[model samples]
Target: MSKRRLMNTAVATAALAFLGACTSMAPKYERPAAPVAAAFPDAAASGVPSAPATDIDWQAYFADARLKQLIDIALKNNRDLRVAVLNIEAARATYQIRRADLFPTVNVGMNLQRQNYDVKELYTVGASVSGYELDLWGRVRSLSDVALANYLGTEEARKSVQMSLISQVAQLYYTMLGDEAALKVTRETLTTREDSFKLTKLKFDNGAASELDFRQSESLLENARASHALQTRLRAQDENALALLLGQGVPSDLPGGLELTGQGLVAELPAGVPSEVLARRPDVRQAEQQLIAANANIGAARAAFFPRITLTANGGTASTELSGLFKSGTGVWSFTPSITLPIFDAGRNQANLDVAKVNREIAVAQYEKAIQTAFREVADALAGRANLDEQARATAAATASEEARFKLADLRYRNGASSYLDVLDAQRSLYTAQLALVQVQTAQVQNRVALYKALGGGWTEPKAQ
Candidate 1:
């Protein structure tokens, strides 16, 4: 046969082989149905119209200027968030690399040879494709799909990290405010105790009051002083914790915090339908992406049982003299094809397929767990919602009544209408009630923050232009 006819045959053979091997062995993918309630408890049972938390804008949801500023700093500087962003870049790069494998790589090169047995030198210039694997069984495509899924998973993971960071900053910021408010209460109490101690000491000096009365006043003053010192340390510790969350020093320019009563978060956020959790929660979406990657891996494992085809081809001109390398009629070409069939693998392929199946099952479980955890969190937050306001109101009333009782007892003691023991008891009750009131206020505010986060209300997606 003529050289031209042989070249034509080789080209046609390669084309036919390429066209024949294009079928995929991977199973079709269908998202697993969410395995939880169709709607949140009260909203479902009572048919209440609930607003979706996912639709709320985060800045509007928080509504605190200092908190928004802190969240900005955290998104910029938190180490975990930075790592998550980097992971996305890495996963995307890996997917690109795997995708490139589906096509042949062509390279150009030059070579010169000197024979040891002969005194002549030969030169060759060529274009070649080296060991290009043909993805006839969709093996490369399946692997590329896996990498793509993982890349998407990484993106969702970054979003999950962002949401968590914002929630943490809000919680820590509120805690610091509570600590500062508690410290203020202690300082004011200390000042009142100091004035009372001075009066009692003067009465004792004048022999108008007994040593027991004077010592009792001194005891109350000392207790206030100790409490003041303790609260001061606690407030400082809270500030330090805020610094850590900010990933830098707390800004001196930060706006004064809202009183627990003034934190602008709504008392309750509507928990939307439970089925929406699959689409709204970042962790759940990440788990689903992971499941997709595992399912793709099963296709790659199945492809392993078929033959892998590869081709290595080179075309160039050869000459006895370096100057004649590209001369006509000096052309040379070759095509080499190879096929690998796995006859025996000690059950490695079967094991790989099994592992992929098991991983997919595990991912399904994780996905379900994420929904269950989110459901429980929202339910717990809502459980506190219906009662916290009433609790805080009752505690405040108790505090006010105790303050009145203490004032009346102090007046009666000075008038000799009651013993100092009654005054001491009233003072103790008033102090306890005051502290309890502060705690209830803190709880009412913190519970709102918790509900906002549980409902996935703190992270907003940028509007599409």
Candidate 2:
């Protein structure tokens, strides 16, 4: 046979061999069973209205205009979220690189050769494919699968970061409102006590009130002043925290937040079935993708037991004279195929396969743990939802009653019908009750924000502009 005919037959045989190598050694994939309760305990009994949390857009879920504005700014600017998105972009590029390995790479080259023995010069020009691996054992395909899984996992991670940033912005905004309310209360209390102190001092000077009464009045006035100063510091700190989340200094013209009691967040967030809801959570999805990646690694490790085949080929024209390189009868071609089979490696292939399996097992545990953690967060948020509203309501009623008692006690002491100690105790009780009510109201609002995040409410696929 001529050299050309012989080369054609060899190429055909290699093609046929590659066509026969279709089966993968990778084990079939099956998702592990969920490791938690079927439904959120008391999710329905918590009186939350029944609607898919995911279906509610963030703008509607947090109805305050200022809050919506803050969330918009955060999604656009938060540094952590920006990094998460960039990571997805990087993973996608890596996956593209790995996928290209399934096909042969082509190159064009020119070369000149001289041999001393023959005293001849050869010129050649050709397109070449060098050392392209044939996926005879599915090693390349498995690696591609691993890369794809990682890319998908990174996308899910970006969503997780977005959800956290939205909730953080809302929570910090509510805290600022709560502090503002407390400051208002302290200022009013200070004004009232200051007037009372003046009256007590005047009465003491007139010999109608004892020095003890004057001293008690002075103490209450100072206490309110101190509380006002502390609340001033706290509110400023809350603003600074918000600025960090916004990824810039707080805007001088930023709109004020709704009162803590008036924040219009949805009172009830439906958790649905734990298994179903957990499936939608980005963190849980990310963990499962990681598990899939580990499983794909096992296929690559198992492929090591089989032969690795590589093919190299070049075709062009060669002639002693450069001008004659492309002339008839000057054409040259070469095809080389190589195979590598492991004979002995101190059991390295087996050890690698074992490591892959162990990693798969570890991934399984992490997947389940992700589900468990999501379930716990949702349950905790639901418990807060069920109880905090009632707590705030009861605390508000107590505060009102204490305010009335203080008025009565002051009147009685001014009439000389009661000791000044009763008035002092009444003032302290009213002040404590008012602060407690404000704190409970803050908790109720903040819990709504928590439930929104725990249920994976804030993020959606950004629309193409």
Candidate 3:
């Protein structure tokens, strides 16, 4: 055959082989059935219904301006979240490298040499493709797919981190508000007790009140002092925790914040079907991506059982003299195509395939567990929503009743109708009731934040135009 016809035939053969490389051995992926209940257990019991948390933006869900600012700061400055973002960048770069392997790498170069027996120099210039695998069994492509899945999983992980951070900041901020309220109540109680103690001491000195009355008043005064100190310490510790979540000290210029009782968070977020809610959760999506990567790895392992083909080619001009390197008569070209067929490996490929299959099984388990976990969280949050409102109302009523009882007891003691002991007991009861009310209100608001997070509400932000 003529040289031109031979070259044409070679090109056609290469084109056909390249086309054949598109076949993938990976199993077709179907999402596994959700391993939880069809709907949340508490969804039906909590008859109150509202918008799904997924549709509510966090900025709108949390009514407190200060809390929104704190969330913004945590998203930007938290160290754990920063690490998650960096991991995404790193995974993207790794995926880019894997994708680059699909294409040939061409390089241009020059080589110079001199013969021992001759004064003339040999020169060559060429552009060559070296050791480019033809991917006949889709090994490289499968690996690329694995990398892409991993990259996507990393992105989902970042979203999960952001959602958790938002929830944590809001919860901690609410807790701090509770602490402050409790501390204020304690300080007021302490001031009143101190005044009562001084009045009792003056009456005892004038021989108008008995020694027992003075001693009881002194005991109450000391107890109030201790309670005030305890509350002060608790409030300071709460502020420290809030600062840690904020990733810095609490800003002095923060916007006005709602009291724990006044934090009007969206209380009645809808809990959709388990499948729908789990699909939106970032951790669950991350797990599914991991399962996809494992499936792709099985394809790569299976492909290893087949032959690998590689091509190395160079086209250039060579001349004994440097000036003639590009001359038409000096033109030279070479093609080297090779095949590697596994023959004597001691079951290494089979072991790899087995390992890949086992890894895929593990990934399947993990994905299902993620779904189960998401369902449990949403269910727990829904239960909290159904019950916390009543708990808060009951606590508030108890606090009010204690307040009225304390006032009546103090009035009776001043009129000589009841002993100071009755007044002291009522005062203590009122203080305990007040603290309980603050705690229940804090929990009420925190439960709302939890529902928002469990339903995958906080990770999304509007993209800039």
What is each predicted model's overall lDDT from 0 to 1?
0.80, 0.86, 0.86
Model 2 residue 21 CA deviation (Å) reads: 8.0
| Residue 406 CA displacement from its true place in model 1, Å | 2.2
Check candidate 2 and list the clashing pairs. Answer: none
Worst 10 residues of 2 by lDDT: 1-10
lDDT of 2 by residue, 32-142 (tens): 999999888768754547577777767778778788888888888899999999999999999999888877777889999989878478888876778888887788888
TM-score of each: 0.89, 0.92, 0.93
| Model 3 weakest lDDT span, ten residues long | 1-10
Assess the local accuracy of residue 199 in candidate 3 as a C-alpha lDDT between 0 and 100.
76
> Which segments of model 3 are wrong by more than 4 Å?
1-17, 44-50, 206-213, 463-465
Candidate with maximal TM-score: 3
**What's the C-alpha lDDT at position 76 in model 3?**
82
Alpha-carbon shift of residue 426 in model 3 (angstroms)? 0.8
Superposed Cα RMSD, model 3: 2.6
